[model samples]
Target: MKKLLYAIAVSATIITGCGKDDEPTPTKVPVEGEITGDITANRTLAFGNYTLKGMVKIQSGVTLTIEAGSTITADKSNGEDGLVVLNGGKLIANGTSDNPIVLTEKSKVAGSWAGIIMYGDAPIVNSATAPAPQVATSEDGLSLTYGGSNAAHNGGSLKFVRIEYAGQVITTNNKEHNGFSFYSVGSGTVLENLVSYKGNDDGFEFYGGTVSGKNLISYGNSDDSFDWQDGWRGQENTNWFAYQTGIGNYGVEVETKGVNNAFWPKVTNITLKRAAGTVTEAQSEIQLDAFQFKANGNGEFSNVVIDGYINQTTPTAFTGGAVQIRDLVTYDNQVLTGKIKITNVKLNNTPTVFIT
Candidate 1:
């Protein structure tokens, strides 16, 4: 068990009132019957509470649709509770803004379970366990093999939901799981208004996928708020605050793999903020490059408002190399003729490179 927190002390702060002290959480009466193994048909998780005790793989020919205001709890005693949507599987989890569906842990602690994994047949370059096309299950220490020719493949719908306390490092090889791991998921899916909190790993991560998203929020999480890799053409529509609690690591950490391929994602209408805390707390404890874009990732970050950062230049704003450093005027096809509208930030050190 490779816990990322080795005495990582963090003050318990509420983000969206999910596990906050001011919110009234619903009690979960653990479902007795097992919802494990491969789901066979169209199963609708109606207004009720359920528990998943083991590995659940939604077989290809089925649609697992979860209704609004539904709460699904998990008990990770032996680290088995995980939801995997296969290549051809479809999920329709449509929760509203007021009554969003919530998937939480029984203990309500961070690093509870493996996490939700969405797999598809997208395109990729090279993989350690996968041979470009015919990828093996040994790649990510699990059975979610990703990559294909279809760029518009639809895995399912994960909208208006709160995924809390997932991303448990199950095994030594299984430490990379996030709250929502989109592995080769395509664009024909629906991922909107998704929120992840208090997870031990990244709130959301994309591994060689082309799926876009909207209205994503993460708070108090132990890792990056958003992470993407493997030539992803992510087109996020809109976003809220990129808040950081005492346990949060980064706001956005994007990597282009060792290939350093020139790939970009369109991120629009967002505000990045680091919550105020002690000098040695979350916001101030950011690394040399907190919001680093590794492997020369090119993307359009337009209409971004940054606030509440102690020293903007200490942990450099955007740090990464690029094969072709486009002009600051043009990014991800949007023409940004002005600055990123940085306000409320206390800049001490002279700034280095930004948006290249």
Candidate 2:
């Protein structure tokens, strides 16, 4: 039982209302039931082998604690969506590395089910309140309605979890779903030690929020490893170890819509390794653009390494940037040989050498 653990220590001084003088509180009243449709509760809700057919909605000021090793399977046979709506609620999914919480498709294959979709009412850019898009439904014909007043809303925490083989196709624009999709989530939410393996689309996607994360890994994904759209202001300390066996697309990508808003996403300590395909083609590692930041979007990358084989590509397509070359070492048919955007970078091998 391979384990991944995410330890979060929330600063009491930083968190509003959580005063140091306040005594430890006892557990609130528990709300136990078998949910088959939309679930809205103000207390703790637990699930078993039960299949959540529709949307499971958790209201504000409530705490939804999912026990370790509990599996919440969504019905995918129907055209419904499997969703968990947390509008002003807190989620404490504390799964240990050995007993991780698994969110998978009903189908056994690599890509079979829709992923978890979260929406809040916190403030969002260009809109005063939550954006009202078409509510997604569940496989059992339940409408998962969310997104209002709380646009940049905050939730609980997601630690030591594994979202496997998710991200099903829902629309035609290639808006395929993701393993864990966060829409209008606020700075209050914490995500740590999460693993998304073998998804159909993006492993983890964020629309808008003030998110901060650490120790995250994505394996064998079809699209980007970490994709951020809308306006995401977060800090990610990630170790992006991809499939040494050829699995997904780029390592990390940051894009925005226009320049009116700021898409200033800061990433530190990122390590991207090439997996399958040729090093060049499959390992085109990091892509950064100000699509959403427009004129105001300023992206920053520090202390990173992008080392792999340069699959035969046109010279015009082989341009590199940012990642330090000296701190990188290659294996097999791979080698570290050049310097990219540098604050302080070094190259160990001779300048003309191909093998390190």
Candidate 3:
């Protein structure tokens, strides 16, 4: 398996309401404020139950460390509540399985909030120079630039985190924020044990990044569960996708954007579970392709199990060598997988994103 375990070395300290320290970390400072400049000091946000009200930014050359067991809710009334880690900025959000961190909207509705974005300067295809090392900036209004020769660029650490009711819509098209958007991040970045549930857009989307991920879960996302574009070359492992809603799009959506065709990511031990029914016949179950690859995208899938989806039509644009699609498993003729079996763990009255 292509388990990129070396990407993140996370701490195993779980903190609920009780802390191991004598004096518990003080609470009250909400994630509500503007950061127009650099933050030189190390700040610990006591997730004492507060809501993030607007677009919070971590300026370049700054690190924001989040305390474990903290649940940061998004007040998405204005549709702009989320976190953005700009290039050269870092976010260390390390949460334990028992006391995992949660980011979701107060409304608790999909498409009601924006999500986390990590931008970095790493190597991408057609990168402005010959043999191409193309650099790119974020969408309008973000002003975040990414892509460079630094394969060791460290964006930050995110472990045992859950993002729910996310994926802000930028337009009517598929242009929107993902549950966890990794833009031009490098191999030195850390991503693991992340769950994205009921997102409006894709669950975990990568654009021009080389970061590896593990223990990912995406359920009931409106768009793709996992998506990548713009020359992403990462490795992912132990991902579980449970799409019981017909609104879900692709299990894995691959695309190569701009003038770059270097889309290759190693995916291993994937399990896409859905109800057994004819495609488009079930309103509350999966009804589309489990995997969709286009625009010269490539990936290597090993030990994959796609359950319950009756028909899988590969796009004509997707060809061989671009991706090694192997170990395919589908529905068992007439046997239904029954309802999704998920482990629900609630935190501090916060809605828990269901995990397997």
Candidate 4:
């Protein structure tokens, strides 16, 4: 009887242990070498003599870290685009000033890839009401949706980066793409010490968001030096220098035609020397228009210097209404030497007073 009781207890123990073992145990699948080709993410991707052919989409919550001196050349020979589309993803491109991250074409000449397009899910102009903002798609007559959130969006950072000879396509009827295009980027993102050299289009173009930046340099760009469109409320502290051979339309262009009427961009400590080309006979300089401000609303400016060579071709340097100017204050030698017009300005030695 004792032997049988002992055997039954052993059997019960064995059965219980077996039942526990039968329960499913979670196992971690190792994704060691999952990435196959160019379009890859969520893993460390190395570029060695590799050509980024098509649009590379970096998904959200993932970090794409580019090492120093890693030349990610965009293949512009083909109709395909070499772009890094940041769909709420993070790009930690911490390039040093000595060796900046180069985004250029296969050819040594100008006009290369479509440029770096960063799309965030932030509140753009008319984001709540208008249709979702769309980007260029590979298929004909198709576009990708991006940007829309009530809360503040955080994309990532672009620091000590340089884009050379970029921006080829005229994406829209009136506006061309820029060297560094920030589409619907939010205030959470950080951009600083950026250089756009010899780009065919604008140096830095902001579509719509509350993104503030500083220490931006644009040398020999064809289009406008700095452009703001679709209700961008950001503070900028920059040094703008243009060359005479450079075919830039305007020094600073602001066009806000969508929602958010109160478009106030505070600009301070800007040094603009236009028409610095090798040819001295031509006079290429800064030009301002109120069409953008009128379409949106008035703007505010302070401590800005517009220095340009004046000649026959150069129209009135500055043309805008005083009502377009809100709290307009000027310091450190605000002199309009050439054929210029100041509608309503309050000139003060130190503290600026209202003209009204």
Candidate 5:
């Protein structure tokens, strides 16, 4: 009987040891460090805190996947800091509403760092009658050219990503970067639920891209809240909201690099609001309009809501309007020709419809 009891006790001890061995290991926390250099292979950044030290480029044929709840602080004090997804590369940053991916600067001030820039091989129209699609050089000081014939090109996916205090000046001639600059990104790319907050320049600028943006928010940007150039023709853009504060120029500044094309961008369900004390970039009477169309910029915009775009100039030097045509050439060619279609616009606290 004693021998039998000893065998049973040993078996029970062995069973307990096996159970302990089956337990899962705890996930390790990542140490904080600066992220730089060109990513040549597939890499995944798990949930952690990181700093962007310099020009971090996700090179071609590589995929950089960032997990949700990651916080990347831009170390602007070090040097020119920015993230660039080159053409043929991918940046999959998919975050949830509960825990969004945040890229911000430590200074918490505008123009603190260069912002996120992505390049894709998307079709763009630069000449009025070019037989082939034309590409343009990037003005973000990256010294790169972008544009191609891949209308379905896919740069990557971005959701619930917030960029703060970006739009740093990168050129020696005083050209600043936007908060989110899309350079010829194609239709297969996914951009949604993104926020550009308190940038020194435009909140979101598309440079000849076919990728559409959905549920985008631009708040407190100094320049235009939404700006596009180089014949951007995104057809599925919707639900864009902009709130200009402190200093601002226009709610929407549209341009096509002085080219009037048959095809233009289409956007719906937009909201632009300005605080009462908002001032223009010039601090003068030149750029206080809600919507300014120039350089043959034409689009199909509908269901827009404009509010609080009051002219804050001293003694009210000029009359502000909900729509300001910068040149008579754009008015004659685009607006009169029905290329610039703006319908179902609702105004609240707006001074005029067209600035005379």
Candidate 6:
């Protein structure tokens, strides 16, 4: 009787095990549609279309992975659409040259929306002596604090990305956004082959960071092409090209918030060009210089090519030059100390090489 009961139990176990194998596998659905609000957990965006609504923030301790060939369109109807990666957050957006990641607006107008803003815990010198690890509130009206002692902080990687028709004004105080804003990002972050096209404000602006960019293109921006402040020390930057059209200011604007420090950024293989019919911000303003160094700004630039800084409709007073040392203090301190250096310059159809 005991042996018969054991054989019956074995047969029942085999039947139950075979029933479990008949269940179907579950499938993963792709994420699509509008994206907004805060992201607190790790998320991956597949190669598809997405619309940005309001302000989308990637909070700390979270990683947002975007696959290649993804298109994120900004809905400027709200006028607050942008992507902000807070400190300690990571965004891995790596796209190939053939299939680049695109962030654009549907209206296709400049200043249509805010651009990509990232904050990292990198070293920065806002003042000569503020603190050991300098910190300051964001100027984009978010009022968030940033800056730290980590020089090798990794905010994540961005390659072969294109940002178009961004640079929205966030506050009534005239705090405008740039196409790409790196706030105190570190050297471990990767930025390469990025393009900022037809933005209203600056194409690329670094507010005190050690992150270097290579193969950067700023095309047809109304404001300055490349601008940096607060003692940025990107040591390995190369192949930067800027083509200004419509109305613009400087091709490259450098400043250090009046701090005369030993740190200086370095760049190589630069090209700055202004179209023939291009004008300045205002009819009376002659702010079309190719390179403007002010407020103790210092950098080492090599193999530069500047061309067509002349105005066609305006008189000689409105014409611009290749380089301008805006302040006497910067010229005396930074330039005289060999902190500001430019080598192997080639000028093509340039009215003046230096603005006095």
What is every candidate's alpha-carbon RMSD to the true fold? Answer: 9.3, 11.3, 11.0, 19.0, 12.0, 14.5
Per-candidate TM vs. native?
0.74, 0.65, 0.71, 0.66, 0.90, 0.89
Task: Write model 4 residue lDDT over 62-140, tens digit each, in one string.
Answer: 7776644445666667643545545667777656544456666778455666667776666556332656442222211
The TM-score measured for candidate 6 stands at 0.89
- Judging by TM-score against the true structure, name the best candidate: 5
Ordered by TM-score, highest first, the candidates read: 5, 6, 1, 3, 4, 2
TM-score, cand. 3: 0.71
TM-score of model number 4: 0.66
For candidate 2, report its TM-score.
Answer: 0.65
The true-versus-predicted C-alpha distance at residue 179 of model 2, in Å, is 0.7
In candidate 6, the residue pairs with backbone N, CA or C atoms under 3 Å apart (3 or more residues apart, or in different chains) clash, namely: none
How accurate locally, in lDDT, is each candidate?
0.64, 0.52, 0.63, 0.51, 0.86, 0.86
lDDT at 226, model 1: 77
Q: At residue 89, give the lDDT of candidate 5.
A: 98
Query: Where in model 5 is the C-alpha error above 4 Å?
Result: 1-31, 313-316
Question: What clash count does candidate 6 reach?
Answer: 0
Q: Which portions of model 1 miss their true places by more than 4 Å?
A: 1-34, 126-140, 174-176, 260-262, 278-290, 311-356
- Candidate 2 lDDT over 1-356, as tens digits, reads 12332211222333457678888778544333454544555544453444556546565666677766556665567544455655666777767664566666566455566666666554334332434331222221223443334434677788877777776666434456777777767666778778777777677877656666666776666776777655566656444434322444445554443323423566666555444242222444422110111212235556655544233233444333322122122121111121111132222211221211
> lDDT tens digits, residues 161-211, model 1?
878888787675756567888887888988887877778878888777678
Location of the lowest summed lDDT over 10 successive residues in candidate 1: 1-10
lDDT of 2 at 207: 65
Query: How well is each residue in 1-356 modelled by candidate 6, as lDDT tens digits?
Result: 22212211232333234466587656545457677899899998898889998889999999998888888999788768899999999989987765578899999999988888999988888888787699888888788887888888888999878899998987755867899999999999999888888998999999897999998989888889999997789999999989898878899999998999898999999999999888877667668989999999989999999998865466645768888888899999998899988999999888788774
Model 1's number of clashes is 1
